[model samples]
Target: MESETYHGYNIWGHAIQQHEEPHRPGPYAASGTITQNNRVIEASGVLGFFDTDEGAQQAGLEWARAWIDSHG
Candidate 1:
């Protein structure tokens, strides 16, 4: 996971590798979260799955930026 602070909002990239799940074994999914006042305000689930960690992270970051632009 990676995190960044922008405009007082904390954005996080959640990229987890699925090790045992039959549906997505050995792959990663991109999700995003937003935190304000040290609490999570928005969290995403399974935005998309990717073949590489970098791809997942990029998706998460892009999603987060768009969300922040609309919500912040």
Candidate 2:
């Protein structure tokens, strides 16, 4: 993925292509990133992308909910 700036945050998403269908890897997979003063942070598994960010978050949240339901 190319370096990109999002919302004045100077962030870039390091999106990796999956070798399967939907042509995308579940919104959050390998890694996602943001930079500040040359320091990079892991936004991976956080669903921070413009397109699938919501879906990614929903996916994770659903997993969490299911865990609670199963346990409690």
Candidate 3:
């Protein structure tokens, strides 16, 4: 999980490793959440999947930032 503050809102990015098959590594699922004053403003289910954890997390963060930009 990674977090950042944007436009006075807290944005959280999450990367969840998935195991779709045995003896094979699966993709990482990306998700994001936006909060203000400790309350959830918006959240995403699975944005997409990526090969690396950092990639997934970065995707999530970018999604959250975009959401904020469009909404604000």
Alpha-carbon RMSD to native, per candidate: 2.1, 10.1, 2.5
Q: How many clashing residue pairs appear in each of the predictions shown?
A: 0, 0, 0
Give the per-residue lDDT of model 1 (tens digit) for 1-33: 888887788888878887767787448989989
- The superposed Cα distance between candidate 1 and the true structure at residue 48, in angstroms, equals 0.6
lDDT per residue as tens, model 2, 1-72: 434444333344344433455755454443345555676533446443324544444444443334334544
Which candidate ranks first by TM-score, i.e. highest?
Answer: 3
If scored against the real structure, what TM-score would every candidate get?
0.81, 0.35, 0.88
User: Of 2 and 3, which scores higher on TM-score?
Assistant: 3
lDDT of 3 at 52: 86
RMSD of 3: 2.5
Which ranking of candidates, highest TM-score first?
3, 1, 2
Off by over 4 Å in 2: 6-8, 21-31, 46-72
